[model samples]
Target chain A: MDGSLAERVDYQALVLPYARSPDQDAPRPVRHPVVIVGAGPVGLAAAIDLAQQGIRVVLLDEDDRLSTGSRAICFAKRTLEIFDRLGCGGRMVGQGITWNRGKVFFREEPVYSFDLLPEAGHRRPAFINLQQYYVEGFLLERARALPLIDLRWKNRVTGLQPQGDGVLLEIETPEGGYRLQADWLVAADGTRSPVRRAMGLESKGQTFRDRFLIADVRMDAPFPAERWFWFDPPFHPNHSVLLHQQPDGVWRIDFQLGWDADPVAERQPERVIPRVRALLGPKVRFDLEWVSVYTFSCLRMERFRHGRVLFAGDSAHGVSPFGARGANGGVQDAENLAWKLALVVQGQAPASLLDSYDAERVQAADENILNSTRSTDFITPKNEASRAFRDAALGLARDCAFARRLVNSGRLSLPSTYRDSPLNTLDAEAFDGPMQPGAPAADAPVRAGGEEGWFLAQIEHGGFTLLCFGEAAPEDLPGIGGSPLRPLLVVPAGAAPGKAAGLPVIEDAGGLLALRYDARPGTTYLLRPDQHVAARWRRFDPALVHAALARATGQG
Target chain B: MLNTELNIAAPDDFYEALVALHRDLTPEQSSLVNARLILLLANHVGDATVLRQAMAKAREGIGPAGQDATLRTTA
Candidate 1:
């Protein structure tokens, strides 16, 4: 049977049940410490973080369900670690495909392939392919279970006013309209953010001329779970195609259509089926799950923070989808902002601490935009000269190892280091390995209390943690006025696992943690709640660590 | 030696368009465009040896008129 005639593609709508909010019937205006708009993955992740810190958050969403399509299927290792911190890592990892290798092809011939994770000591895989809906569902469940989070659905913000101390929001519910005042407003309302529009801010950048057709199909194909990309593939002449395997046997296929291609005509099943049939044989039994024609633009706001309102996720920036930076970057934005916002709301840090969010994330967004733009240009060359260069690079890639490094289908999202961030205390002592000040805390497996666990799980618990390596315990570090510090003692190999200075001891039995953090015998690391290295020293220095903690919390 | 080659089926049209692309530019702008074009073309022909050969071949027709090898014509 021809694939086109296969019973009209069964479209299953994923809808969450909506319930009337008690706030809808309230007669007076309510005030919340935090009011986050948009219940997407970003907003929900923020809500979970804030709630876990015992802050009451009012989370609002206009829609009552997870995203319809399997958008943002690839979850990077860093993002998985974040989800682990949010308490949903087990479910997501259990339900997704773990893939670390990707193959690149040029016109039906394999050109090059790369392995992402060659090391063996990490807790998570390089990436997992789970649909965006599953991620949101897991996050929503986690957010709902927290008593501090008030998740409201069918609630839309109609107006906003940035006041002196906070922001005012006029929200519309199905039954009636209501007013809410919040000390801080989080706009995770996605790409077409109403909050951003209400604030009269414009995102600026270049919009690519080319468009891509994404199709999610379900079939029991023999394709392995890995990323397969092609440049000018024989099935689709002069165009690029990418295929990936998601959970439940669903496969995502993307085709790059030139700038002049008609989006409407290209989306029709009659047109899409032949394209899929060309790649997968006509006799392959497959059901088309969803189809979309999208043109991506790499745009970001001039600033992520404005007065008392902060933008995150797609609301703060958008990038071309080639690199999976869209949702991955957004989740990172939530992680970065969640800790800083919680500190500000709790009065533990000066509000200026929030400015780091803008500085760090805007820098991150720029990095994402630049990389995605380069990938887009390489995949779809604009002029004859660029096309020639692209073709030459791809052509020479067949025989030359140097040319293989030049090919850029998509770089794949890797967490960018905030080495230059203002909050990072630069290396006063020479260090090696990836774990440096302002770097995301690297995860390593170790023995803790007779059980093996990750290093990151001990540091990111809504407060600063002092990782005391070796037995030399620095005493009486001056407090940063308000924030309490949790001390964790990491003992290297050949060191006995005994509780020293009343801090729990972890045995780095294999010396993996020591290597990952470049830990000397008496090295100390002061990590922020978000698990980013704020400062480190060769040995424990009470006064320097105190000042670094103050600066990390925006007290300086 | 060096493949100073444009694979377009219509070389004349490409040449006309290339020249027209700089028609309205000032002399400095035209020079800038030419420099950028050279860099782009050189980058495409990534092999340094090939680029050197192509540059030597291109310089052959640029000396004094009577001495130019490729352009010297019998009148």
Candidate 2:
């Protein structure tokens, strides 16, 4: 029951407590505020978030152990920020291998090197490569620390009966079968989800014919922590290979196996060793940690929410791992759903608020699917003309910068903004800079009362924040009263000291916040609890702010 | 600068896909498929100069002269 058990425990061998209660000998129906199936990263994140909001959650998983192999390793900046908000950022960031630079190779020659993080003054890195098992381990540890989260391993939901108001679940455990009821059910049960199948729903998309052999090798080689991708390398003639450095001196090598490859033979250690040696050369000594032959697809359900039952993560949608969209997008889904579900459960927001989750995440899933499909298409062109176009782009990349821009080994995962989301209040005034309404709030360096930190961290505690820029917060703002929205004023560093801003004032040390938010003297932004910009204005208008809040919360 | 590089992302997959497209088709049918695909793609490109450069580049890779009838027609 100790909280520190997770920190010192070797997660691979960490034995989780049994799912059932010691005293319960007979099958008795139990009820929980929220029941989340699948204890993977997405479900665990949602459980943690809901528990933090004082919502009791029952998280169930069919398996008792962490995910096998280094699956879904790349954690994007947005994902890290969400993890930070959920109280596990430091551990993940400290253990993760941070890399922003990627080198795209045309055959054996390096054509372009791109920096994902072009600027500084942020808390998290552009991306980190940690094994997926570690991610689930950290989430489980955090979940165990929360008293409100009742985690049950080896508890599989075999039956689902939606009763219009709530869901009746029949769970199969190691001991015996039991019945339970939940106000809401989140099916995060992954690609071949039993929850989705039980409801007779299917994911529809294109399944790629090209298969890939993923070999995780443990080697203490001197390769830098950068993404190295090859297109028709000389050693693996005619096929492409990708290499990435993960934590604990392990490296991920992905080799494209043509459609004709025998899956069984290709997976054999004898066959895989030679191909890996071809990439690493003759003298590099390494041991294979894991090897898997996988075929990917870009698939998603028609809707993410079905009545009180919601689907998150791979259950709702799936994409190829080239862009790291699989787990990263799923985590984003958890973040987007957690707050909305919390509000709906607490009776603070109407049931319509949960509808926004369906709207927003479906759009986000579509964006991920579109990018994934494009990258897959470019990676495995369907015709000679497409190949010709791809080759032309790569060949020109050597000499021309413009052509280099066209070369996409993998676009990599970046946060998708809901620009046209129904919840976003469109800008009534013109503005500049990258951060916009419906986009995740960009982080900036700031100093508050002589303490230096980031802006996003200061306001990410629990609820919505009203950021007033370049001015002192006035007493008793119209929309601030009787709402979860708290007003925080950010003044330019050049502003006069010792001036009371009615509300809490944080100084933007170098005017970075103002510049990044494109603020003049009176620019104000309403940010959601998930750190997404809901609405903004050049000047404060109580009526507009109220309407935007209403729309963002699904009251519109 | 026009893109003249042959750095396709997955050349093996592309080759396999191309082969699959012409799997059961006769030589004449395959030729017609190629012709139709070329015309459709040319229309998509919608640039005469780029198309001409691509044609010239294609011809350059096929050897000096009298190699393919398509090259002679384009010339």
Candidate 3:
């Protein structure tokens, strides 16, 4: 179905066509509510998420087309959930390969294997393998569909200045340069961000003295959609290799070339084809779709927010590709910042609320960087002691179950909880479950309207929600500024209570909601617009809910 | 809770079995076997407090190294 969709179209122009903006011909600089730089995945996600909340945004991209190669291929479950809220999750999942299992091998034997999604009753898979271009192409289409997202291709941000409480940007186009003012600026530009360079800010961290050669090969080999990683296999002695299946029968194979290997020599088809041939033997046939040699560093800015300019994605932080944390974490940054930018732009929340974006996402960046660094260290094993321990673990893993826990083969990305963010209302009573305050809300099967639905869809419209269990929720919540806070009443599939005062009442399909949340009768949870738990109580109380709302919006 | 007493059911047999675990192995292989044994026993214990106590006892007389535990002394 997808193969015929883009068979003969001018793919670049069809995805994002360059057009002149009105400001280029105007005499005066115009102001927009929000302006997002870089039309990459993070920037497009931010634009779509913010525009969905009724904020007008101007999205600028320096380039005229999607990213060239299959750079980022693994999209985690959290990112898919965020994309689901944007109404395009199905398109991405339909065009991507989903996987939840992985295998790790040592020498000639399989040491350990894992299943990422062992439990049932979840809406999305643990992850999906899709090329970076397909992801950007689909996101560009989604951004174009939203009326409020003014996506300007070929508009490059050249100069930046901070005004009283806004940003003045100089954009360069084919015609000429034009000036624009924005109340808020989102820098989703990637590594080597022009915005960061323009502002003269320093990003500090350590860089690995090694290079990885990624070969995206097109083949019809019958490999399952599972991640396979090898440590010192017989084919690639004393080095590592990773294999994954992307859509269109493309296989992503990464080879670890030591620091001393000449990148120029290794990238040649003569060298790459021989290495690939050694692994697949003589029977399999393949063609190299794309190949690149790259190294990575773990770095982050001291602060993601600089006055009116907020940085997201690789602009704010970066890590090695071992954990697949780079793009996944960046997409999460968009989801974290979008709703706060919306609320602040709407005058419904204090600007101080934006500081929590730094607090939460910086913590998340630190966690990702730590994991990425540790996984790289395990994969490379820099010193004698480290190598000994790594080999010992691998040797023992073949016989003992305990050693399997010690192996580290790219700790995949998971949503980070804002455990210490100021926006959370600390639990006053004891609780025991995964839906703790500040954790991303979990998804469960539900019967909404009439058909079976998902719990996350109830708050998909970007509103603060009150999820009350086993009872009818209050009639309406007093919102701070715009729409009223929505209420969702959840009951067992067969035992729903009275209708929630004309509000939508969803039924828990198999009691997974109750089990996952550890809920009792009259339990009410305050979920933020970004679908993160802000507060919870054993029983519903209007006064307490009001306080939590204020605190969550940064009044407290 | 760490039983300092001699708790092996068969003392001579346990000593011989311990020797057999590393029999005919090189120094590096013997050390790896000992390290794996430590990890397995530590996981079997599972009490972090007990592990810490045991570590302190094991390192009682060893002086501090010239570098941090995470850093290389050669550097």
Model 1 Cα lDDT, one tens digit per residue, B1-75:
565577689999999999998998986566556655665577777898988888788788687444211111111
Q: Arrange candidates by lDDT, descending.
A: 3, 2, 1
A1-556, model 1: which lDDT tens digit per residue? 1122323221225465557766656677677899999988899999998888878999999877778898889999989888888888877888789999999999979999988898988889999999888788778778878999988888889999899999889988777788888999999999889999988887877677787999999998999888999999999999999999998889999999887889999999999999999999877989898899998777888999998999999998988888889999998999999988988888888899999999999998988988998888789776654676677677767787766887898889988788888888888989998888888888888888877787777666778888878854445432322355777778875577443755567878688888888898778898888788999988877778788888888886
Interface RMSD to the true structure, each candidate: 20.7, 17.2, 7.5
lDDT of each: 0.83, 0.84, 0.87
Per-residue error (Å), model 3, residue A486: 0.5
The C-alpha stretches of model 1 lying farther than 4 A from their native spots are A1-14, A472-483, A497-499, B1-75
Docking verdict class for candidate 1: incorrect
TM-scores, each model vs. reference: 0.86, 0.87, 0.91
Off by over 4 Å in 2: A1-8, A22-28, A478-483, A494-502, B1-75
User: In candidate 1, which residue pairs clash?
Assistant: none
Tens digit of lDDT per residue, candidate 2, span A1-556?
2233344556666666665654235456666789999999999999999998889999889887888889888999999999989988878877889999998888879998999999887878899999988888888878989999988888889999998789999888889878888999999999999999999998877777688999999997888999998888898877788899998899999999977789999999999999989888889999999899987888889899999999999999988888998899999999999999998998878888888888889999999988887888778766655666677677667876666776777778778788888789999899998779988998888887678888888777667888877556544463374457887788878575334435667889877888889998778899998999999999877888889888888787
lDDT of 1: 0.83
Q: Considering TM-score, where higher is better, how would the candidates rank from best to worst?
A: 3, 2, 1
Model 3, C-alpha of A467: deviation from truth (Å): 0.7
